[model samples]
Target chain A: MTKTTGVGRPRASGAAASKREARLAVLDAAGELFTGAGYAATTTRAIAERAGLRQASLYYHFPSKEDILAALLEDTVRPSLDVAGGLSAKLAPVGARLWALAYADIHLLGSARHNLGALYLLPEISSPRLARFRAERAELKRVYGSLVAAAGVPGELLGIRTDLVFGLVESIAIVRRDQPDLDVEAHAVEGADSVLRLAGLGEPDAGLRDSARALLED
Target chain B: MTKTTGVGRPRASGAAASKREARLAVLDAAGELFTGAGYAATTTRAIAERAGLRQASLYYHFPSKEDILAALLEDTVRPSLDVAGGLSAKLAPVGARLWALAYADIHLLGSARHNLGALYLLPEISSPRLARFRAERAELKRVYGSLVAAAGVPGELLGIRTDLVFGLVESIAIVRRDQPDLDVEAHAVEGADSVLRLAGLGEPDAGLRDSARALLED
Candidate 1:
């Protein structure tokens, strides 16, 4: 946006940058409207208007309202999936790996950057629009289950413990939303530790948590 | 139903029984549809059809689809509120009382009688119709927070810990819906124990659990 010239490569790059910015703008606006208004009640025009774009322009980037929703959900879970996929590479113990994942997930969901996690709570969850997100969540759970099993949680407790990890992380969003003055890092640390304890691991060691936080920073 | 005589008292009692049966039938059918198909997608005709009644007959029992949903939510949480009200009189230790309350709540939420608790996940939770249920749920949280404080959960953890209690109990409905062949009582016990552990309370004692159960039974 600074001192742009009509040079061939520069104009193309500038246009591409603006295009990306518009796409992200639409996504952010849609996320807010979708989470604030029920998806059923949110319309393409509303999303477009909220994004300060024409409906046609919105459609040019995202084909449909459902597509927008799918994008929002994908954005929410993509980071968790990435973390889950790479957890083993960190070479830390199962508890640390889990703490890393839960910490990142809690921070994302609890942050004001667009509460895509709230979409998961929608009663219309039965709607097929969420099938892709559901599959992703199942994969996320599988990762948690593996980490939980490695942490010495009994076989029988796997399902409940997995549920507990999910509950602890997701509850951060709800808690932060209600108590907006919450300390995010403290809450995230507590959530990650609760997940560790839920898996039958002892309360996470502060040193281990520090290392886990460093890994997430990476 | 077994060809009762049309005498005065017999006819009156039989009519009352039949009417009550019809009401329950509608509620069960509506619950299945509302939780399975979702409230917005479900229609009165469908509920009536599922209940094996004429649409008019269904209307006679419940005035609207929203009314039916309200009934389901009220039916699910009313029992918990009632038990929570009486918990103080049970005279159990803090841990035992907490365990008993959580056990009963999990059982209710997990029961196949109606996973209407799932309905609370609906995107339409903000609908004016759910205001009454929301108020009731807030009261339930108040009761839970009081018990949680008494159970020795530190003041600092109360907000997140209370949220954890709710998430653990409510997750049962989600877990049961996913793992349909789940052992209900076993799952409930584990959920209750997990809640106590989340609060830093140790595993509840078997004798204490029994005494608390007896109190609930009373």
Candidate 2:
């Protein structure tokens, strides 16, 4: 028996394959441009130019700049949310849920880090797009918030914990963006653990405390 | 006993009094401009024009734009630091010191609410100025960090507490800036209390929590 490659070659040989690759190339270029110069400052023509494709070809893939932005946000945010959703469903006690969420966040940050600048700053530059994005983000926050609140934490306490956890993650991202030399992964893990302990999710086990100490020392 | 009203009036009389009043007027106008348009966007000429003074005369009181910014930062940040400093010195238990810092921060936010937009946005737009400001702020954080660390808390745990306390205050300011219609003073106080509690300072009486909740419910 011969081993077969997963999702074997498409029936539409050269032209379709080239078209699909071009579309993906456009999106990758747009994501980079949007994240670097902000949405308002970037243009469809520039994205096409960066992707080494004609402007019309860029339009073939994405109808407008907002379409590209929406796609980018969907591609980045949805997977992380799905992971978080899955983890929250699987994790039993609050401690495990919190740890899982932290893990998911760290992974999300690694993948979505570049787009985060665009994710945050673009909203201010474009209101209609921002409103839609914010609505989606609020839903995600609600999911996370409920998971946290279900752990017997008070409503107000949950709000603070959510903010602390999110803010630390954001701060870590900012640090990573601004200062590439720092050990961001370690910082993110240590920061997340610190917040979990502070939120009373779990007592700081000796090993965890020692790990936290080592990270801070670094 | 005579009240000595205007006894030390300058020999230059009307011109000096008018100039003094004009300078105050310019500073006041500059503050409004800075708060509204941010530091980089608000020009000195605009501030002078708003105050009905010549741009040259604006420099008579403030040597440069930075002088005005420094004045604004000092006026806004110093009182809060002073309160925190005094409280840290006076409060006996570490937890009480932390609570007092939270209270002071909430109080500061209440009184200096209008300055927050400038405070938050300035750092991102003007790195050099922000660096100078954070140098002083780092010292303050160090003082607070030491206080938290000396409380028998692990160093890593103390770092998280320090960041959370500051993040809570900053988050409240951001929320209040975005939602001016909200009762910001109440939110600040409540946020500060929530943070204090999460830091393990909420025990026994819950006095701080009660006070904060009372303000919010009002």
Candidate 3:
């Protein structure tokens, strides 16, 4: 596999690489540009140039810049949705499950090559192109709500707890924004613990934490 | 006092309101444009136009768009800092002080005329123009730190807890970005409670709540 450069290649063959590789390259470049220069500032031409693809070839992969942005946003949330789905299948205590879900979500946010989560709230992201990503994130939030509710919060407190629990995990973006040398592994542990705390579950039992860890490991 | 329109005026007299009001109008327009159209997309001329000022007049108030943005950013955090400072002078339980600080900060974020807090993490905000706002926010975070410390977070958990506590309060931006009809009062209550929970001080005492309320009311 030849290494892909982030920019400056003009060869048609470079962009003409297998379609799958080209698509991933476009997403990677869009993620960086959107998170760094911001969504509105990053034009498709810039994204194509950054991806080392001619404008036409980049178009072949993504019809519009919003399409590219929507795809990138999906990358940020889909993995956690997948993890939540996987965890729901297996039997586990609600606190442990919540901990496991948060751990996996924070790990993904912290470990992504780019700070894609920063783009999650960009004003431009509400376009129709992002409908699927919105649905997925809302689904992810619902998963958080169920787990938080199971922790036995009063009905009135449930909405805020669920929002805060999700917010605590996504705060990794805020952490990563300023702390360049973030220790993702340590942050994942502490962040998940914090989520559990906001859910009204104080310290996770050692056994419950292990169970959460085991679920995540699998 | 004359009500100002958000757009569509070329009157010199309107833009020539007292320097203080003109400055405020510029900041208000910048806040709306920056949070709605996004920082990179919003031009200084657009802000001036929105504020009913000629470009030259807007420049007289804020030398650049970034300066306008920096001023708006300051508005989001400064009131909370003032509240925190006031609470510090009054005798109150640490947990109550923390709750009041959180409540006041969350209220400012939610009740602001514009969602200025949404611009807190904009990529454009890192410019030198925002240095003062950054310093002030850092100071506010330190106030939160001392209060969280007084709540007895151990040395090891101090950093993450403080970050999460701050993040929880700021998460109102995220909430407001989605829910236009947000009940800011109810959210301030719930958000402050969540902050206490994150500080390891669950369920602030009713007496403590009253003390915090008294501090804010004053």
Candidate 4:
């Protein structure tokens, strides 16, 4: 699955849909290059070349390389951000809510459409340019921390467990690099289950899992 | 723990003992710059400068940047490799033995020394230049996979659990990035416990932990 958002459709250069298609094309190429090479080493020319466009044309869509990255982060990270609204995770049973959040996060990250997960691996993520993206991601970690705590992880152990659980979810991105054929939905369930276990919750009961599924789907 | 090997030591460029000191100094500098700027963007000149050596003198310690990275991996990752010699982990209870390996691994990785764990974060690790190092790391992963299997993770879920457990352990690397005041020994204990829980082994019995402690001490 190589960025199915607009990988094969045909489009004209002078219309509204053309701008949309070209933007997707550029994103597709940039994700590939950024994950292959470090963000700094990847050049606009290479991105344009891979997208089948001229170097000069790239600026017509993106103000700079940073903007292109901003768009990628916005596209991929927003799904994880949207799953739990305004820190509402504390309202439900901790394991069930965590399952919902983890499920939603893994599904979006594990999507066959694109390997946007690799964007998290870029060292350039520390750059001032990606500050907002990092902040949003920090909020997401806080959510995980809260849920892990509510599930009974001690205050002292909260940070380590949160890092471990998040690592379990995010490792899917690294796993995708080697095994592109990964089953996204299956891994999501596994990830959610493993996270619950780490929170000392073991497997979620059928009822809790059902509630989490209903909540996330709604 | 900024690389306990020699953070406070002094060195000159001439004697055999001094040559060993210079080599460690180069690794220390490379670890800092490589994790800071990334391996591709970090130059031999910058590394030489940081290590307080002339460009010409760097070759006396390492022939190339890749060799410098190889040395870092050898210095940091070898503790993990040395823990389980030729599948000797089967000699003990799978979970307990894994606890020992994970403890040793996390101890080395979580050391207050230079963040050599970030060396795992380098995107250039895939280059042919680091093949042996990668193979050694893979063998360590295989040990983890076997331990996870022996601890009752289903075969279908084996790879995912193995990956998750490895991510949990390796995550101490990334976790060190934000929290520099990390307590290495404490995290090693916490990391080992989290890994067991991922394998469905919550906290080990006191005697089990103590016995594994004795085994690892050997």
Best-performing candidate as measured by TM-score: 3
Model 2 agreement with the true structure over B1-218: per-residue lDDT tens digits: 11123456665787777776776677677766765655556789998998888989899988888777766565555666776666644525665566556666655654563544224433332346455555665566666667557656676556655654565555444444434465544555455545555465544246645543343232
Comparing 3 with 4 on TM-score, the higher-scoring candidate is: 3
Q: TM-score ranking from best to worst? A: 3, 4, 1, 2
**Candidate number with the higher TM-score (2 or 4):** 4
How would you encode candidate 4's per-residue C-alpha lDDT over B1-218 as one tens digit per residue?
13235445565534655667677778888888877777788999999898888888899778899989987886676677787773374467877788888888888888836777666645677888788888888888898998899899889889888877887787776677667788887888877888888887777666766766877766
Fraction of native contacts, model 4: 0.46
Which segments of candidate 2 are over 4 A away from where they belong? A1-77, A110-126, A155-169, A173-180, A194-218, B1-76, B106-111, B115-126, B156-161, B194-204, B207-218
lDDT of 1: 0.75
Candidate 4 segments whose C-alpha is farther than 4 A from its true place: A1-14, A86-92, A112-116, A119-121, A205-211, B1-14, B86-92
lDDT of 3 at A208: 80
The i-RMS of candidate 3 is 1.3
lDDT of 2 by residue, A84-154 (tens): 66654452555555555554565465445353532443323234654565566556666667766765668
lDDT of 4 by residue, A82-189 (tens): 787833744677788899989888888788366666656455667788888878878888889988999999998898778888877777776676567988888888
Instruction: Give the number of the best model, judged by DockQ.
Output: 3
Docking class of 4: medium
Residue B173's lDDT in candidate 1: 64
Chain B TM-score (each prediction, in order):
0.89, 0.73, 0.91, 0.86
Give the clashing pairs for model 3: none
